[model samples]
Target chain A: MTGPLGALRASAVLAIAALATLLQVSLAPHLAWRGVGPDLALLVVVAAGLAWGAHSGLLLGFGAGVVLDLVPPADHLVGRWALALMVVGYVAGRVRADLRPDRRPALGTIVATAAACSFVGTSVFALSGLVLGDATTGVGGLLGVILASVVWDVALAVLLVPVLLRALARLEPEHAR
Target chain B: MTVLDLRPRSPEPPERPGRPGPGGRDDARRPREGRRRPVRLPRPATGRGWGDDREPTPPRSLVVALVLAAASLMALDAAGALAPVRGAVAAVAGPAESAVSAVARPLTAAPDWVRSQGALRDDVARLRSENDALRGRLAAAPYASNRLREYDGLSRLTGRLGYAVVPAHVVGIGPAQSFADTVTLDAGSAAGLRPDLTVVNAQGLVGRVLSVTRSTATVLLVTDADSVVGGRVGTTMDVGTLRGRGEVGPHGLLDLELVDRDATPARDDAVVTWGSQGRGPYVAGVPIGRVTKVVSSVRETAQRAEIEPYVDFGALDLVGVVVPDGTRGDRGVIEADGTLVPGEAR
Candidate 1:
């Protein structure tokens, strides 16, 4: 459903996504809090959704999630993150679709969306684990990871998303400042 | 438009403080739902501004299709169809990962330095890794004695278990890969590693081999959320399931659940692996951890104990993979005093 993004814009987006995955694998792991780290890739997907539209969001989220699943040190199933982030992307894109074209979103809105979407992404990942009968932790364990992820993602989103949004906005010729 | 969407949007045009929309009077009182809002606001634009109706609501079919795709991926991954693609990240993670860590170490160290304990913990992590690096260098050294010390330490360790062991270094940590807590090891199928091998350190049980590639294997640490090892109570010899707490805090511990509800687990009781059928995943008599807290549920009549593993998973450096073969030439002999004497010769 996506219009063909210009080759330059597509390459830029791919580079950013690769950079996000690189940081997620290397730098982010060192910054883990309580066994969960901030999800830079999820934030990138959220930005892609908001900057473009729902279709763009879905495709990017799905693609980025697959990269995360394939990357080393990820022992969980391959499709779990892909599924969770795709939902996040769609929702974030819907938020973009809902806003009046003239009115830009507040910083509060973006971070709030990130926090809400972080919860969704984490819960979906955990629920999939449960459905597969592979959920190792009980409810209490799930809650800790959920809480930790929300805190970290929210913290990073406030800093990362705005910069990412600007970069993504440059890709869209018609998008206003 | 998605009928499933329930997010509420602000219907009011509150942003244009000076210039109101030309359709302001008509745009009011409209229900602003996320996916179903099809109203077009009459706004004067220089051929660029998108109307509200122009906003694309992703087709529900697309969302459904993507979700189904994700589920299928999970199923395929669960069936072990994605094993070849699993450790591809580690293969590409050589100098790039190391450079990122080295460059960011100061930035990561800054916040922790302000707090004394965090700094100390960082110091320990750094030193532990440095120790691992030194050991790696020592093993690569041309001198035979340098190899002997590592072999001596590992041989003494394997002597206690009476198993041939392959020593490996922890190459990387994985908090970035979602929920599972794991470490990438330098050893893989090349080191004679297969899935379900018992992994241990100088202190106690670390975890088991989850998956392996040609040169690198991922070890699912015992502290992961779903790791289960059969543990024997040190005092009573009652066998119970040792679960990785998964909730690692300043005080992380495993949960031990005995099969017999009547089995009483007391604090300070030692717990050891109860072994496996044919000794595949876990061997018999490896020190797992010590019970420090016992919590009993009166309603369910279930009792479980908390064990503090002897090894600090946070600072893992070196570990041994216990090969189940007992007939190996380098097997350690158990003395009458239960002291393991390292086997002699190459």
Candidate 2:
């Protein structure tokens, strides 16, 4: 991938990732489900990973995760999501790209992936908080977060993933075609 | 045929002269006995076997480096080493969040506005009905209070009480869901408000001023768990410590403890503030509540009872703070410490 088209693709990916991360931070409170909201940032990373390959997935995941850590009301230690989302992105990217367009994984798979991402993301956050000497953030709260966020994320992914995949396809570079 | 051979296979194209085949069979198999490891791949030949050539594996070295960097950042953040960095990020993100809020505000408000219009009409009708009821109450108020004052000798007592009362409006309420029982009053030091001053309404004792700023004062409600007032039972004058129960109700309960075990004050007995010596946090003879129940035991040294406060702490709107008479009248002067003296006040 090179030249002006490649530049446009890169910009589009970055813009989408940045906008999604910001929206997750800003609008999540209003859409809260018992103190948790769908991690739209994680969804964006998974979409980027599934559309592109591992290298692009890891990059976008790290960038969005770091932005999420820095945002206000984010009281946890930085890089927790960076690590978790990076792994999620890498794993999601591993799904066979050789399949025919019509032979892609079913909706169940996407929903499962969303739930898994929510679980992994929350576990990392809680474990990191424990290591950081935050004794009060107990496992019960983490479990609640996982339960609430997974349902919300799965719902969001159902609506968001296909649109994101289409947008990514539109931005595919000439050589990638 | 072997199972591997029986598996359906996609056709493979011939490899370029120098470039290896897409499968990189040699890469999957161990390096030849004497050959050195290739510089292109970061890992040794024992790396996790083979991924599909079509789906690129992220460089292990890059992934390791990125993960290590992130871990280091987490450690630094946990150790509070990244405080300044976080502050800088927040500084940039705050305005961005504000802009997002501006855009989302209308969208969020639209549904609320539509719902509230119907609610507003209902509220208006309800308030109109309440206004008529209140008008009737107002017509009867002067006569009732006058009769009560005469009946209870309240005016005679209040005249002797000598405290200046400053009227204040309740402007805000602390979150009801929270544990801290407090309210914000519009009156402050400028209005002769001070910490430890008593706050009350027509009904009875409200609370004491906890802190006072130039324009606002925080009043700790009598219903707070920590609040305690000296109270005397009506007629019997059985003095006891009136402690707040912090109950959940419009008029929270108070527990009057340390009463003389022999003093059997009947239910519905009125209780009033026993007054501080220097006209302190509680002034003498302000009605506190009525005895709801009395709990007594032979083994217990002192009797206890629940008193239902006359003032509805949850529904406070207007209240008065007790100050010195000097602050209340022009003829009396206020001292540097806010104590009212005999001289004329400015």
Candidate 3:
């Protein structure tokens, strides 16, 4: 996975990440349910980890998180998303590598993994924000935000994860054959 | 199709030692080219955990190193060293965000359109708006003469103040990406906007420009929890601090803490901004909101109240950025009774 094809695949991942960050900043705000929107960027990173292995997940997560941090109107600390997503990707890849290594993941498995990762990523972000200071949400509000983020991510995972898996799979068809 | 085994399948046929089975797909077989590794990866040792192409341990160290880098970035950003770096990123990402926001603007309005799509309510709403506009016209008819008499004062006032406004629109509002309340404006440094400039809608004070890129600016709304503005009660003239509660609508409120120990703040009292020192961030005498509820501190002498903002942040559209015009030097302040107070605001 380290040749020209690999480079092409990595760029494709970055493009998807850029698109996710764009939508998260522009369109997601309007789609927000009860002041909580779906975390498209985070979900995409989870998909990367699940589709690729742990190394790919870690790299893509950091890159995507930076875009999210710098998107217009973003006010959180620059590296908060990067850290949260990096951890999320590593864990997601491990889930695929361990537990159910050889077989393709079912839709139910994908959704469950996404929900779990969403919870972990959001909690890490919130906790880090509190530690770093400048966080606005109190403990009670942070809990509500996390719950909402999980729900939104799971609902979207039903559609997004499978599509992402297929796309990533296409990048390595030569190896697969 | 073989690559994606989405459906449940039975286990593959067990392979013999020296030679692989006919399919040889799931087994530890190298690629035909021999230069490339198999996509599904050479299967790990017996009793190894699931389907990944590579071992997972390397990623563990990568995660730790990246996390440390993130922590250092947070520290640098907190200490205010990342402004230029952030600006550079925004310079690249701002236009894309603005373009997408503009393109998807109708999508944002789609919810309301769908809600109003019912034929009966659509007609009713349209007629109501038309009726309101006509009624507004008729009501203004009686004030025509009054408006004419005030025109002289308005012209003089404009001439004296001389600070013109640059019109802009809100391009985006945040959700999960940002924890605080912020919006992206369609205008930025090219429009002569800088940080600390006041943003206002026709209703009242909206926010202040927090950061500016070449073509876009981010405004920190008055409804963010970290936001604090100097405010005063209209009737009592008791100066106090008004803080945003990080929400919108009836539930989201601005907290007003009065400075005077004995100041009695009442419900329905009007609140306005007490201008910043240099007439930036906030200008004097802009309507902010009305007090919805008042709660006096039992322990502390300072009284508190809740304010419902006049501007509907959810539906913000057109806005004005107050930029000081620095031509025709020494334009004095406009006070009542045709008196000029010499613009000494610094």
Candidate 4:
């Protein structure tokens, strides 16, 4: 019973991850504010890390990050996102043990995870900008991006994370048996 | 107890004195097999909570994070240093965008279909109303005979000037932001257009061709900051420099600076091209506009007058590109031959 349930959980997680990638690429552009769009991939990485342990979280983050690097508007060096997401996933996984099993704790975990992911992602972009000799990456624009991403991510967390967490909990084998 | 005794107990095998029997060997193997060795994994304790009560992390949080990151990256790259990455992403995203567009096409058509039905009925009523208004205006227009006379003078001048007129369409308007106060024309090299060709409408001189491509050309309107035209005030033969002061809505104002400091410019004086020694792009005696104001100052070298152009540039649908007669060279030979005395040829 345990073995079969574990396999089902893994497959379910993978499917959700794939779906998240698809949505990030296809739907995120339309929601841009002043030409700034939200980052769905970062949200997915943070969630994966919180759900699974550190090792699985790192693997998931790396895989999704690679797919994103391959997808549109190839502007940056390919491995930049991979490295950034790996760190984010690892951090989220480490924090999982500290979170309580109640509803409020789950919400708090998601909010915190989103904030951290946003900060890391923005910093990576800023560093890449500096490395590439782009003069427009001023302090003001960087701040604006960070603020916008955090607000957008937090809103998404509040609205969508609860429903997703409930669905995942339902899929657990112990509950099913 | 009596029933148990009646059951014959097979004689127990005599215990071996020194060496173990086959049954002892089987008994020895059973304990080893039953006590299975635990697999020596690197982190054995980590697997203990495999079926624990911890909930799976919400996918939405990760999705939100990814979206935020992607958007930030795109914005940064768009305004910052990741131009090459932006291009590559745009290339890969193109097909996905097209697919989405294809799916959304039908959804977008519904609004247009509804709007078209409403517009068709309104258009028919508008046409009927416009026809009635135009008929009334036509009847009233004949009463303004003096204005018609002025138009007749312009038509007669065009006919007698022998200027090769190539009709062109206006493909663009001014305030292009890049080339302020300039317009793009549909006619270009393919239409026999060349740089410095004089462009005009029925009213008067418009501007000159600045640049030309195979299918299009940019016209530097007389009202552009960079444009300077050699113009004269009416029959006074007062020469001046006509400079553009950008555009003011539909009408562009020209600053006419008198060549002679003492030359007095009267309001409503007709401004015409003061042709140079075959160097002026526009022909001599073509009307430009009317003087609106005279600006004279103590420190200024020459008095300046503001001229309101005769052409309604905003409504200009068709224009004439003046191809000077002598430009073709063959016309000059034909003219010289036509002027020869018949008896002197022998």
Which one wins by lDDT: 2 or 4?
2
lDDT of 2 by residue, B1-346 (tens): 1113212321322234456545576644543344333223222233222222233567788789879988998889978998998899899888887788778877767756887999999999999999999999999798666555432332233344455566567898877687657899987887767899998766788899999997799998888888999999977988999888776556678998856778877899999999878988899888889988989877878898889998877667666677775574322332323333442345
Please give the C-alpha DockQ score of model 3: 0.24
**Sorted on lDDT, highest at the top, how do the candidates line up?**
3, 1, 2, 4
Off by over 4 Å in 3: A1-5, A99-102, A173-177, B1-52, B115-346
Q: Give the whole-model CA lDDT for all candidates, comma-separated.
A: 0.75, 0.71, 0.75, 0.64
TM-score, second chain, candidate 1: 0.51
Kindly list the per-residue Cα lDDT of model 3 for residues B190-262, writing each as its tens digit: 7677898877766677888899997688998898988888999999899999999886442357999998978
Residue B124 lDDT in model 1? 99
Query: In the order shown, what is each candidate's alpha-carbon RMSD?
Result: 33.1, 24.1, 31.9, 23.4
Give each model a TM-score.
0.46, 0.48, 0.48, 0.38
lDDT at B185 for candidate 1?
A: 85
Model 1 chain B: ten consecutive residues of lowest lDDT: B1-10
Which has the higher TM-score value, candidate number 1 or candidate number 3?
3
Superposed Cα deviation of residue B273, candidate 1 (Å): 82
Against the true structure, whose DockQ is highest?
Answer: 3
Error of 1 at B76 (Å): 1.9
How does the DockQ of candidate 4 come out? 0.06
Candidate 1 ranges with C-alpha deviation above 4 Å: A1-11, A175-177, B1-55, B93-95, B111-346
Interface RMSD, Å, model 1: 4.8
Q: Write the per-residue lDDT of candidate 1 for residues B24-51, one digit (tens) a residue.
A: 7454333333423443434434434332
